[model samples]
Target: MAESAIEVLGVVRPVAQVRHMECGVVLRASDAVALTRAIGADELLLRVVQRVYLLEQRCATLSAALDALGASLRQPRAQAGAPNAAPLEPADASGVASEADAPQRAQQVVRCAAFPRTLEKRATDTLHERGFLVRPSNYDALACLVYMHGFYCVGVATKEDFGGALWEKPRTASDRAEGPSEQKRARAVHGSQQLSEDGGGAAVEAAAHNDSAATRMRQTSAPVCRAYYKLKELGSRELVAFSDCSVAIDVGASPGGWTSYLAERGCSKIIAIDPAELRQTEPPPPCVEHLRQKLQDALPGLLQRKGLAADLYCCDMNAAPSLVVELFTQAVPLLKPGAQVVLTFKNVYPKKRVWEAERDAQLDRLRSVADDVHLVQLFANTPRECTVLCRAKQSTEQ
Candidate 1:
């Protein structure tokens, strides 16, 4: 009940504090006063409920222990004077159930989970007065305690752990002068109570609001999928430019997210090629052409029939980097002298050395065809993957 009302420190959601006690069962308590007020329960009534819940949990734990012990003891016991024979020890004597006595411990405790919250001294003192032992904890000891006990233990974190959790430092006088916009933005991004340390050890307020403006801008003009965000990062940096009537090609453009983005940015005509089905919320604009086929298979016919010479080319294929280079090289004759090409390089190798080598090779191939090549890790990309933006040289040079 206390967990229900008391907010979990360093977390935005309070419900995250609720811990499971067993399979299909949960135990939650809140500050007595808060619980009473919320449920219209008097102090005595709350205490009665708390006692009942505690009794139920103890019963469940005891029942599971007895079941495990019974199953173990059922196995053939050693003869009266056998070398391995030992006297039975009382379960309550050491406050520990031995593995020899309880091999089913894992099964017994599998459903149980504990909730631990770092609390101020006053709260710990209150719990202690109510007969709860609030132990002090370091991150390492916390895991050991939880594992040894087979249940949750409430404890306070060490100074180092506490310091790490409080990431924001108090803003200076200059920061306050930056205006309410920053403060408002921080609150919008991080819903949690953010505190920065002051000189006196008191906490000052700070929020993760530095990128609020960009987040808002993105929300207002949200694109179809995550692909839009990658392109937005590139476009916002002025990495590539597009004109009103610029012809473009989107290889592996299944879903047409990039095609839609290009259309909105004033590219007059686009050849979107993918063997997979295209998914769109609405029918595409007249300038857009969706070819349900692979880029390699369709490019030659498209070039011959339409005399296609694209001003912009985009590809995001999950294939080898060498294949990507070959695709661009083959399409060079159908690209304008300085056509812009934006592609993604996926790091398929698990090892760092292999990944770097593959990436470097891709960039080298890219440089051979384009005068300028920029490889950047886009926010939308997974670990080690990057987006490559380049401008193709003339066919004579190619």
Candidate 2:
């Protein structure tokens, strides 16, 4: 069909068959460092990239191919300095690397500002007919492919270069829309997946790197700040079972959104601890007890007095994960045996090491005091974070 279309237009198709197709990938600009490290270890990718990458084939095909290569896709990572700067290769265990290294090359960029409606529809349909997965043109994925390939041919006109084409007169919406006859083609191609919403970018980037930003928006519509969505998802998934449990200690609980969520969820008592002032809610939910002191400082005293033993512990500290783990480690003895701990391990700070390094380091610290550590990328989390749900191991068991 593609050949027929070109022939009908008196145009010649490129003779070279695509032995390997390049796919674009988008990641959280934040977790790029660690995710890059993981991608480096995998051999399936023709080339790994930051904002986008070139996969050898569809994600499913690559996974199978990866198995044959004795490798698997790890999340891609990024360099610490500039956003556009080339990322460094992973270092050895001791934070050291051999001096002999090749420098990274400059990347070509593609910006698809506009394209004609007929061309867009034909390209979409042809690719779908050939079983070639193309991320929607709007997504960063297709743009990456266009950047790497130089020009992505869509329909009537083949864009020769990125800069000139992107700066050309923008096509009107009606000019961009599929004609009545071609609308089915548009829908057919769209059936594969949407790059911006769900596609290779989400599969490799979010599943490998982090989750969607849309998740937070979709899961909640509360008046509270975005932080409220995190706790709301935690409970909705039964990840923490806050409603099933009676007492929950919320560390780093400023803004009181979690407290409010807990109160609404029917948690009998919520001890919200933070140094910052919490926003006052009307009638102030009776179950929430705001403690305006640092959890590290206040929790230890509570432990000393043997006054607080909670069924669950939760923290969403903006501090380093290691520090949060340390504070919680000391307070583990104050938690009821087999109580749950739900926390967010965030890549909130700049790091010299990969994200796994920080996550493993924190988990190591937590293991000494707690157990059953499972790190999950929640729908509510952005690319920079993950939710950790664990239980305080029975003192006698571990």
Candidate 3:
């Protein structure tokens, strides 16, 4: 039947003798089959293309709706090429060094002032006012964040990020040890009676050197003092009077920063109390007695047995302000009538509104027991916490 169909589709062809006409019916039939198959394939492809187009349109509509709904979306944009941003070079991995002729890289020193605080806005403002730029090297940014949000001291990167850069002066081993020693000798010689007998020019020269040395010392010490003073300012202010020779109690004294400050000012004796050991592991300060116990447990007995009464009781325990205040209230009877108590309250718990309200209430309660109270908000305080300086109200004559 297939052979008959092929034969029916063919036409006569011209041979060697007999004349034959060729219609190419078989070829035409094959061409028709190919055309029909192509048509079928094209129709299938067209349907696929249409489906794809419809899917794309649907995706576009869904994307637009999401955008309108304010869903989290990221728009693609070209990356910015800032002029100041430079690519970092890989470190020299090879151990070899060229001795004959080598280019010496110049080290540039940068000076910066950082104020560590919690409020970024405030810290930025303060830095701007002080003529500092907010850059990658500036730790004041982190400090500001810390100040605004209370964080543990362990996470503080001030020493790592800001300290090294701010004070990166190269020094030799001998230079490091000898520099201060020579300074001391020079000062001693200048202040000696022997120097007094010298020529006026020598005296003048000595005075100039002394002044220069003093300036250098002041410059070197300024940053530490600045930070400390800022912290002190931020802490609540109460009348902290230092008598010529008097006893004081520094509660929650870990590193003994405050106790050392007091001792330097000629406080005869200081009872440094803390659960943690003081950082100065070598020895306690000459006048300081280290009490390795919680303040609550040791305070009452120590006061009674020793018959010791402190003129000033400074508490900087990191506990909640309310607890510190309550402790103070309990220990008040142990304190002399006219003695002054300085306590630092840190509002560490979350819910600032509730903390503030509770703090104020505690302060109000303290007023009923104490004579007169002065409450001052320290500028050094970050948003997380504040220092409260309290004094006992006793008779004016007492």
Candidate 4:
């Protein structure tokens, strides 16, 4: 594909060559701080900008890179105020940088999440040699030198630059999981702020820095299953408000990955319907009721329970499309209008156009009974897999 840049930024960007879009990080060429502010304003571009680092230099050695970085901020500004009034060396950044004001904003610890573990040690050593004391925790790092691949990305960032940041991959500090795709953009964002459902400039900016959302499905603790990350992102994105949700229904909930997430999100009651066993069954959560039967068999008894109307329904079944459609149609009456629905289209497996056709049929079936049917590719999902999201439109009483 041709090297390109979006119309708004006016800067040509290089898209990373990665298998999945979620893992592919795009590096943008920027000239001014205003360019970064522009990216924060664009929602579509925000997804690609998981992290933002002002690239001071990409030197052959870590020491050389730090020397170059110090030189840039050293520029004598007659005004004696912000460091960025004069254009900083635009390395390979395409996204946001914290606005310049206080001088201490530049204090950053040195770090890297790229491959070749040696690079991380080398960068830290070089920073230490240069008098940058190692912080006890990544969160305590006000800002830091971040290395990716062989590129030396160092610069000044905000105080919370490293605080509560998902700088390292889960269970390890290595970036091997991200591979070379981690080197996509020039500007880097620290651990991104918590996700916000309320969309606007702030949310876009916050999300731009948080790679966790872009990476999707990161659990702070051990997960029941990989599916935990999907629902985690859902709550992070505000697609499903788990905090307000009281009752949730999990269809085909074997091994209870989705059900486990529902309970973690604070759902007061989760009815997991599956023929097999859930991993959560060892002790079984008090909040969960396991109905070990098919959706069709368990649904009738499930509905008769007093004062029960589920506010959320999640269906992740690996069965025939028509059968799923049949079961969902039957269960649609159990929801009140405005209830949220999430389903995984396992049929998206690559076989040919046949799978595509199957996915399309399911889309049509969902749209007939639900409002705002949105097809989304969650970060936790494989390239061939996707998820269907919608809200119930009609009530059973009607």
Candidate 5:
């Protein structure tokens, strides 16, 4: 039977050689003339097989690079006393050990790798064969360098990576025995090809790197709830009057997170207002009263009816600061003699300025409306935003 024409089209190289099923080189074909001339069907097939093997080898190398890069970025820094290091237990019930006996945590490892293109299943298989474990994990790009080579070289030191920790979970018995089904394998290969066609492997690697870096940042930073606790602590000492028997108004209060914090701090009552509905998994604190209306519209009427005012008005509405300032000014008259306001101003304007200048300008504007204004920029554990704590002056004549 005549051999089928195996088109060696679009591959990196045009010249191809064939190897038999038993690994013997049967023939070499550089072009059409060489392919057709004197080759029997079996020999021609062998030549195609050799070319495929070479191509697969090249692909395997590329895949290894990709995996290494990913591992480096995802791997966490090693600490000296971490589980992987020398084990030592505390002698006391408090879980505190004598300074002399404590083992220092190891420093984090840094390693990196790069791939020319997205890898297919075959590439992953090759990596496994080459002694690289399939780490079912993800990582950021910058950290990639540290993970691949760090631990192996440093032998474990004590320092946490700011990015995040790496978790290595061993595969289950079932997972080790099972391979992806044909359909899934095909889909993965197709996906890799698509990624390569659309933006190439480098772009995909870059995105994965960025995502991992961002994840690390989030993990290391304090949560919003924690930030509130920290703020309460700060206010208790530096500005004790700010929280003393205070009546507060929380704008855009949904989920009542901030409102709950204020309530816990012994605020007299909090008029929680938001256009959106509050979704509370548990009953709200007794001090909070939910009001369903926009702050700009509802605050004026609510203030007029009360005749007296809130001690602290906290605006966290996801709206423009200028508009928020206007609404706050309108509601200012309703505040008690020495009320204070805490608001967050998101920089939604087209132009950007230095952080100090922007904060100062906002404080200056507030001073114009109130008898006394004090502004403190609270560096909350959030990115791209800060808290502005303002105090209203008390009239001395009254």
Candidate 6:
């Protein structure tokens, strides 16, 4: 089989946007091929697809689906658990899956709907019944997504094959220049297919990525204010360990949403910079020092302090992207080498393409002072807003 062997099974609708957003297309052959062609071709789809599935069988009922699934699995799988597809033309030594593609476990996508809600138990049972090992894994999963009407689609791929799988999870220095994964390029090449301007077919044709975070965000509650939940969601991945930072600066920390998060992380010295009263300070956060002034004025006072260095600087200031970046840039000089920064670019404008284009331009400015800048549209964020993560330049790892 070639590396770029599998086709998209169908539109994988995330449950949250099934009714509200433009999605919920049932996967069909024509749509899958059209979507497959667009995978690397379309600027959007390249970031959207997490995994490619070779549709083996689809059944209406959960039991019948697994029964058919068992039969498909019984067939000799591609050598070393490669999916039932041809490889993209081999590129180099780095292009191979090697042992990374080995059959691990049958995992399920966290976003899509599951019928009978007993999907996990039943899947475990079927794998056991078929005489297969069932060691579950989130890193490299042979995933299944159950759509509306008990529709089921099972596919095989590895963490590398779906190289974009972790793209949204975290940011790293190497990822800045790493265009696409070598394994991804080796297995899947761009097909020059474009979705028609009339988005009727695309509603269900090209579904979005899995792991919808918006649903999780709505379910979350915070003591200070809802803004606290943003950092809670941001740090939940453990990619940027907030606990490692002893000192932090929460810009625009009024209602104290983000300030509360730093306290929870056990950050020793926190400067809450804002003019408005901090509602969370009524109780007076033990680790926080409230700077009751604008950031520019607060900077002079903060510099006078004998030992002033920040390990983390976080801002979710409700302002234009340009103003936000400008304010964030001013604080870069006060940070310890390699201090991490987090900012949320609010969706003040209506269009994604326009804001995103402007967003990247602002991010490039950070290049002078920071490296490994990442712009991600998080599930926890509002529809158009995005999260930016970067490390201060000229910093050594602590």
Judging by TM-score against the true structure, name the best candidate: 4
lDDT per residue, candidate 2, 1-398, as tens digits? 11111111122222342322223332223333234334433222211222222222111222222221111111112221222232222222432212123222322112211121223344344333433344323222132111112233210111221112121212112222322234333443343222321112221222211113323323433335446667777766667777567888889887666666777788888888998877646768788888889876786567775556788888888877887787677667678888989888888666647777988888877776777888888655656788888888788343
Q: What's the lDDT for all of these models? A: 0.48, 0.48, 0.41, 0.55, 0.43, 0.55
Give each prediction's root-mean-square deviation over alpha carbons: 21.4, 19.6, 34.7, 11.0, 23.5, 15.8
Better structure of 1 and 2 per TM-score: 1
Q: Which ten contiguous residues of candidate 4 have the minimum total lDDT?
A: 192-201
Off by over 4 Å in 1: 1-222
TM-score of each: 0.47, 0.46, 0.44, 0.52, 0.46, 0.47
Tens-place lDDT digits, model 1, residues 1-398: 44444432121212333332111113233332233234332322221121111111111243333332233322232211111112121335343333355332222110011222222333324333433333321111111011112322221122222211222222222333343355444332222222222111111122222323223322443345446556656676677775523899888786566877788888888888888766554655887888888877887688786567788988887776777778888878778888898888877777889888988988997898897898877545655468988888965475
What is the C-alpha local distance difference test score of candidate 3? 0.41
Off by over 4 Å in 5: 1-243, 304-307, 354-360, 371-377, 381-383, 396-398
| Candidate 4: segments with Cα more than 4 A from true spot | 1-16, 21-54, 58-164, 169-226, 232-245, 254-257, 264-266, 276-283, 296-309, 318-323, 333-339, 351-356, 376-383, 391-398
What are the per-residue Cα lDDT tens digits for candidate 3 across 1-398? 12211112223222321211111121122222233233333422221111000000011122232221111001111111111112111113331122212232222111111112112234334334433343322122112111111211111113232233222222222223334444444433232212121111122223233333333533441211111332334322324556532878888777555676666668888888887766442465678888889878886578676567667777777788788787777666556666777666677767879888978887887776675566654444334555555566674232
After superposition, candidate 6 runs with Cα above 4 Å error: 1-221, 395-398
| Candidate 2 Cα errors over 4 Å, as ranges | 1-221, 304-307, 349-352, 396-398
**lDDT by residue for model 4 over 193-298, one digit each (tens)?**
2222221122223222344432442433445555666787787888777887798888988767788888888889898899897876457789999888998888
Clashes of each: 6, 9, 10, 18, 33, 16
**Candidate 6 lDDT, tens digit per residue, 1-398?**
12233343345445554332444334334333334444634323323333344343445555555554444344334432343333222223342232233444453222111222235456655656556544322223343434443456444444344323322222111222233344332222121112222222121112221224212322344245545656766676665789788999999888787887788789998988999877663567689899889898888777777878798988888888888788877787678888889988886777878887888788888676688898766545655577889887765322
Question: Could you tell me the TM-score of candidate 6?
Answer: 0.47
Q: Cα miss at 352, model 6 (Å)? A: 2.9
Give me the displacement of residue 364 in model 2, in angstroms: 2.0
